[model samples]
Target: MIRFAVVDDHMIVHDGLQAMASRADDLEFVGAAETPDDALALLEETRPDVLVLDLRLNGESSTELCATVRRRHPDVIVLVFSAYGNTELLTQAIRAGAAGYVLKDTNTGRMPEILRELVRAGSYFDPRIAGSLLLTSISNPSEPVSFSERELAIIRLIARGANNHDIGEALNVSPHTVKFHVSTMFKRHGVHRRAELVRLAMDLQLLD
Candidate 1:
């Protein structure tokens, strides 16, 4: 069974998701929270395999929350379920470790199947934004960056907005190791902040 948790401030969303999960034989509704902190606590207790999160949680940035969950519970997959379809937010969520992006207007009845596909494939994007993502990917040059394979891997995660801790967990390395690589990359690229590094990566087409 696919254990699932939800984080959304809307009671209706919670109720709707609960009903949908209950109807699915392969899905188990673990819990729900209206805030990121509460969601983190619930995740700790339930250890759900997947978390359906709202992009806006009482004004809190969901991208940061997604990164937090990924850092704390590396095993859990986060699927962003939001009403907003802004490309910036969608990109940010993916970079922050979300495994999928689904619109709130999407048929809740189909969410169980969507979540199943997400877990099986490791990632998914709402069809609305798929074309935008494809265009963005196509716009990026195909030239490779002048870095070692490990460094390139780190750069890709960095471009995805991952912190040292998140990158460490994803790559199965120590945070210190991630930090060392990040610092080296910083010196090589003459950039100090994570945002700068991400911009540089984009300009150089270092992330495919």
Candidate 2:
């Protein structure tokens, strides 16, 4: 069995990934964490074969944590399971030594194959991610995500049940900025309510 651990701030995200990972025979959900510190502690003791991680973890830097995991436990493969899909952070993650970057928006059904491929093929990146290192010179499978990186970040927080004020505090930005992003996102979706934003995110696979 390929030992696996998933880390994210929300319990729902953790439970969802776990459920998806459970369907495969080779993958085992050995551990989970709600914060970076919790994940690091689990990593030190368990020595899992792979880690499914999130980008935002209650004020901690998931990118830095990925680097540390690579440096400290060279054997554990890190696969980022985040909502943020930006070129810079993705590039930084590969440099930090992550095995792959799979957006939470992608079909959760494919994750088992991805985990297996990471261990067998040494690395993997989501085909649906633009500028993904895993893709070749020919065709790009990902639709060009139009929103700016900051907008993407706020969208994720909103999907995770965070209100405007909560999102602003989490991102260390002003509530006005959060409202701006939220409104822009809604307008882009041609939506007039928060519920519609959630619906669009789900329908478009913008969030898992």
Candidate 3:
């Protein structure tokens, strides 16, 4: 049987998944959590083979938690179960070491098969984003992302733990402008959080 845990805030998701697992002879619902901290605790306690993660937990992106799970629990396959079909978010999940991305709108009956396929093939992506993902992979996937001087400045400030307001003040720009730049950078870099963007910049030697 495939033992799986979940880290999504919605009780409906938790209850629905549990019901699905109960109906599937090959799947087991090990546990569930509504927060990242609880998710960590549940993982440590259950050590399940798979994790069904939501892209957003309490309005915050859970990609970092995905990375942490992969790092600390290498054997557990992190499967993203999100309502979003945003290509950048999907890219971020892939970069964070997720094994699959399944949309919430997908037929719930197919979930068991999807999980099994993920375990066997080692990766799965929603068909809705497959075309874009393919194009992205075909189009210079190895090329480094380019950032403007202003963006670099904003990134540096972000690395120093500056919020939007602080970065805007430092750069003599409005917070809204700073937000726009940051959001654009997030999409361009396929990262969800400031920390991830800073790390990517450092990896590419963009931040000195």
TM-score per candidate: 0.66, 0.63, 0.69
Task: Go through the candidates in order and give the clash count of each.
Answer: 0, 0, 0
lDDT (Cα, 0-100) at 29 in candidate 1: 93
Ranking by lDDT: 3, 1, 2
Itemize residue pairs with steric clashes in candidate 3: none
Evaluated against the true structure, the overall lDDT of model 3 is: 0.86
Lowest summed lDDT over 10 consecutive residues: which window, candidate 3? 197-206
Model 3 lDDT tens row, 1-208? 8999999999999999999999999999999999999999999999998999998888677888999999999999999998765566677788999989998989889999998998889888888776777777789788544678999999999989999999999999999999999999877555688877776666445777
Off by over 4 Å in 1: 140-208
Q: lDDT per residue, candidate 2, 58-97, as tens digits? A: 7444778888889889999999876655444566577778
Which parts of model 2 are misplaced by more than 4 Å?
130-208
Relative to the true structure, candidate 3 has a C-alpha RMSD (angstroms) of: 6.2
Worst lDDT run of 10 residues, candidate 2, spans 131-140
* Error in Å for residue 140 of model 1: 5.8
Q: Pick the candidate with the highest lDDT.
A: 3
Model 1 earns a TM-score of: 0.66
Prediction 2 TM-score vs. true: 0.63
lDDT of 1 by residue, 148-196 (tens): 7798888788777788899999999999999998898776444567665
